[model samples]
Target chain A: MVAHPTRDRRAERREATRAEILDAAWELARIHGLAGISLREVARRIGIQPPTLYWYFDSKNAIYDAMFAEANRQLLQLIAEQEWPTEPREMLRMAARVWVAFSTEDVARYQLMFQRSIPDFEPSPEAYAVALEILQTMRVDFAAAGISDPAHLDLWTAVVAGLAAQQTSNQPGGDRWLRLTDEAADMFADHVLGTTTQESQR
Target chain B: MVAHPTRDRRAERREATRAEILDAAWELARIHGLAGISLREVARRIGIQPPTLYWYFDSKNAIYDAMFAEANRQLLQLIAEQEWPTEPREMLRMAARVWVAFSTEDVARYQLMFQRSIPDFEPSPEAYAVALEILQTMRVDFAAAGISDPAHLDLWTAVVAGLAAQQTSNQPGGDRWLRLTDEAADMFADHVLGTTTQESQR
Candidate 1:
């Protein structure tokens, strides 16, 4: 059966409105800390009644889920689009830099994804899948480097993400942690990765 | 000069009250997220009106500052009370475990010191000095370990703090990162610390 033209046009309009609301929420979240934004303020910014927002979003948590999913989608695209180096160490180094850069780019998004900023909020399964996909990408990279152990994966994430956390928390746009990114990548590649079968193979 | 008996008694009472207020605030912070507590709630818990709280803490951020200072003092004490291994690598392994344990033990304190949870809340110079003192102790340990460069210090902080963060945020009470603490400490000792002169001295 052919889709009805009016129904399709109406669907497009609904999608456009949802996108507009999300954009406004993110803009406010950037200024206020991630937990600072409220549904009322988001609605006021977009000149919509709060109830109208409820029509699109079940609650503030739903909006958070959408935003989280969107952030991951952007990250997935960023990773896919980058020209990665072939050498395993170089690639991990590049990955570490990108991970920190992505996190620091928006403090709010970084908090939402990495931090339990919102009380009583858990990402919906569909939204969480996006996050899982991002983790999967990292796992694949680790596998490529001949490191498949979950413990190693956990340690690498802790090291890489820890630098980003320090950079964003202590000194944004500063070289304190950012300068060490390359050095750190080298350290992990030499120190941590050496324990892995990958470097042992070399 | 020797203090008068009356003045000494009054000073003791004041200090006692201040400690009581701070304790109540921390109890509430643990229940709510670190940033979630209000002065009113703290006052109510301690059976005082909110205005009375101002006698001890000038404002909410002042309370946060006190809390931050208290947390660091505890850290300083914790470090001092422990007997450290003489072996450089063993000391680092112990240090890594202690750091993660300290951080996860009190999530509220961790957020205040490291995560930047409170908006517009900068720790007062006095409170921050305590923090600096804590860092200075870490520096002394690093020096003893023969890892004197600021780069090594930065990397070490990232790795230790990063694991604490993952443990608290992703898997509190689970050993995903905690279990790797020994192995990670070894990795740092072998790779990063081995590059230092202290390890060579061994």
Candidate 2:
């Protein structure tokens, strides 16, 4: 594909506008609940007519899809940035900490990415693919620790995601739930790996 | 306090109307999301003027509070009705199965009771007290199994609730996530109670 200089500049500007729109939507979602986000408010915040949003997003769900994809991409980037521990148990604990922190820090993003709370908004296949990739990465990580069962994977997600849920719902901005990340991870490791926490630590 | 016959009848009638309103709200919530529930629609469904609803519920949030209390009360009844197994491990697994079934069967109630998805609707102290009772019951049951640690309780709730969340969000009306409930219970019991599935079974 040949990119004309004029077209490339236009594409860059379009991308920037799209990013700005997502930013506004997120701000509104944070203030109001995710279900409370209005395209009109998003446009107003950006100093544009509500109808102008259609040029960038077909509908509110489209904006949510983009946000969904963006959130997962951010997660993937965060995972990449981490220097993962070599030992499987320590690695799981590290992953759990990262997840709880990531989820509780910005609850609106957490709800969009994890809770499926938004009415009638299913993440597009493109966006959902990113989520699947994150799971695939988790699978590989678990397999490295000699834990590859599908049921085990489900249990692991529940334990970690549960911690995130508890933290976000029961005590936002508090470490009461997040502080259990290591114990939860170790419990999971012990169950799936058939080793005790002391053994894993050793 | 002595109860007058006329006042008792009036109280009974009011209680009946309140139940009807909650039923309508749940129906709407099932069709629409929890956040989508409207007092006007709920009133319309039960063939009452919008203002009449305010008589029963001071506000939309008040209706949500009643529903929250109702859901937890239902859970408590279900717990009481169950013929609990004598073995602590079996009892825990049984509790997990019961929770997954109850939660996944009604996504709206699950969101209201668990997800905290409703904007500006905090469960009243009266409603939240019921939830605390359920947790206390769980504490007693776990204690019977000699798994009395606070961290263990958090881990247990996370594991079971995770299964329910996965089933509801990923596979509503499917047992894909629910099927892992027993395994998850065992995994948790193993971690906290120091008992393997094989030993637990015996």
Candidate 3:
């Protein structure tokens, strides 16, 4: 079948409008934090009336859902492209650095995806699947280190997430917590996987 | 100077009014979240006009400051009353459990203190002093466990706080992260303190 030029043009316009609205939302969110996003302000920034904004997205929440999914997709893409270390300890260090950088590099994105900053906002199921994939990667990292229990996964998330939280909250642009990534990873490997590693070495 | 009965009564009333205002604020916070708290709604709940509410507290931010201090003071008291285990590994478990409970028991209080939830609200120095005391206690516990480096202190905080954040935000009323506190503490002991303990035992 021949491609329809007008339909393609219309589709391109629609996609561009969505990207425009999302870009405006990201800007507003960075300035005011994720919870500060206002659809009216977003529409105003886009030079569209609120009704026109609604035509593209049904509600402020729909835009948030899109943003969450997009951020997750971006994160998944980043993880896919990056090479994880084969060594268990180095792998955790790399993973920790990635988690901290991923969170600290984008404050609003971190808040939306990790923190309960937004009220009555649940990421769409598709978005959550992406998040699950991110978590699955962590489990794989833990298992590679021979720390594969569910408890270990939970502990690892807490350990790394805690570092990210401290960096973001207590000292943004500072390595107050980020500085500990490698040492923490070493401690994790030593304590959580040390006995196993030692026994295997024996 | 001798205390006058009427003056004493007036001071009592003032203290009671401050408590009343804070209580009202907490109720509103629980219902609408920390950011949802409004001076008008707080005043309305307490049967006072918004301006009249200012007699006890200067502003909504002032109320938040008081709540932050009060929560910190309460946590300090809780830490004081609780007995931490003397055994190095068990001590960490105690510390992690205490930290998790302190946070998960009151989500609003935890958010206010640990998270940069309110944009403009800064806790007064007096309250911050109380918060420092709590952190100081963690160092003491770390010392007791034979881990004294500042990096270990930073990592321990991350490990425990991450668990609390997961419990509060990701899975409240669940032990998903809480269950890992002991294991995490053991990891801390092994990696951060294990060698020291072994050396001391010799």
Candidate 4:
């Protein structure tokens, strides 16, 4: 059956509007945190009445779901697009760099995916599936690089998640935290891949 | 200088009350979350007028600082008291267990120390000194185990910190996240000790 031109246009408009609302919500949530956000606040930021947002999103949680999915998608895309090195040490370094860069660039997005608690909210199956895909990719790459231990994978994932979470917290000093994070990442890479370098040379 | 008996009693009572307030704040913060808490709410929960809270803490940030210091002190004490194993692998495993267990038991306290932001607060010179001592101990142990790289210290710290942070955020039906953390910790231990176990065999 041929779709009507008016219906197709309405569908496109609806999608665009949804994206606009989500973008607004993401920015507001970042500034005020997850608890500080509401549908009315998001709509106000986007220059629309609060109820108009309901047309596109069923509720604030719906918007959160969409925002989270988008953020995860972006992170996975960053990892996917990297040109990984063949050496195990270099591969590990590349993974750390990608992970840190993605997290630093999208602090709010990262928080939504990992930090905040949203009551009664279940991420769409697709989101969890994609997250697993990212983890699996890391697992496969690490294994191919001769990291055949299950324990190593567990540690790697935990450390990576920890660093990501740390980026979102209200730590005391910004410069110190950044230095610590970079130093920590470098150390983690060495531990995982056993790279030989002056810094690694105790 | 000799103090009066009544003065001594009052001073002791004040110290005890302050400890009670800090303990209550830590518990409430954990349940309601850091951002969700207010000074008034904390005071109310402790059965004191909000203004009276100032008799002990100058502000909520001050309370947070005390809580953070207390948590760090406990963690450092736990780390200091740990008995190193004869084998490097066993030592690493023990360290991971102790770190995870400490953070798990006092999750709110851990969050206060590492997870939340406190503006205008710096780690006291004493706290900084103790933190360095803990790192030094870790470095010395790793070196003795033939893991000569000092970088491993940073990686291990990040791994432990990350695991603590993630476990705090894990929710009901978050079995996948929990399993991932456990696996990650095991992998980290193997990476540190240069040993592979059956779990890593897969």
* A24-43 per-residue lDDT for model 1 (tens digits): 98988888888888788889
* Alpha carbon lDDT at A146, candidate 1: 66
Tell me the spans in candidate 3 whose CA falls farther than 4 Å from its real position: A1-3, A140-145, A195-202, B1-3, B195-199
**lDDT of each prediction vs. the true structure?**
0.85, 0.86, 0.84, 0.67
Instruction: Give the runs in model 1 whose Cα sits over 4 Å from its true position.
Output: A1-3, A195-202, B1-3, B195-202
**Which candidate has the top score in lDDT?**
2
Full candidate order by lDDT, most accurate first: 2, 1, 3, 4
lDDT of 2 by residue, A45-68 (tens): 999999999999888899999999
TM-score of 4: 0.70
- List of clashing residue pairs for candidate 3: none
Q: Per-residue lDDT tens digits of candidate 2, residues B108-151?
A: 99999998788788888989999999989888887887778887
Which residue pairs in candidate 1 have backbone atoms (N, alpha carbon, C) closer than 3 angstroms, thus clashing? none
Q: Which ten residues in a row have the lowest lDDT in candidate 2 chain A?
A: A193-202
Q: Per-residue error at A142 for model 4, in Å?
A: 5.5
> In candidate 4, what are the lDDT values of residues B43-98, reduced to their tens digit?
88778998999999887767766776777778778887877785666676787778
Model 4 residue runs over 4 Å out of place are A1-3, A29-41, A50-52, A83-93, A116-126, A136-150, A162-202, B1-3, B38-41, B83-94, B117-152, B170-202
The TM-score each candidate achieves on chain A is 0.90, 0.93, 0.91, 0.82
Give the share of true interchain contacts found in each model. Answer: 0.70, 0.63, 0.79, 0.42
Span of 10 residues, lowest total lDDT, candidate 1 chain B: B193-202
- State the RMSD for candidate 2: 3.2
For candidate 1, what's the TM-score of chain A, rounded to 2 decimals? 0.90
lDDT of 3 by residue, A48-146 (tens): 887898888888889999999889988888888888877677788888888888988888988888988887788888878989998887677667767
Query: How many times do residue backbones clash in model 4?
Result: 9
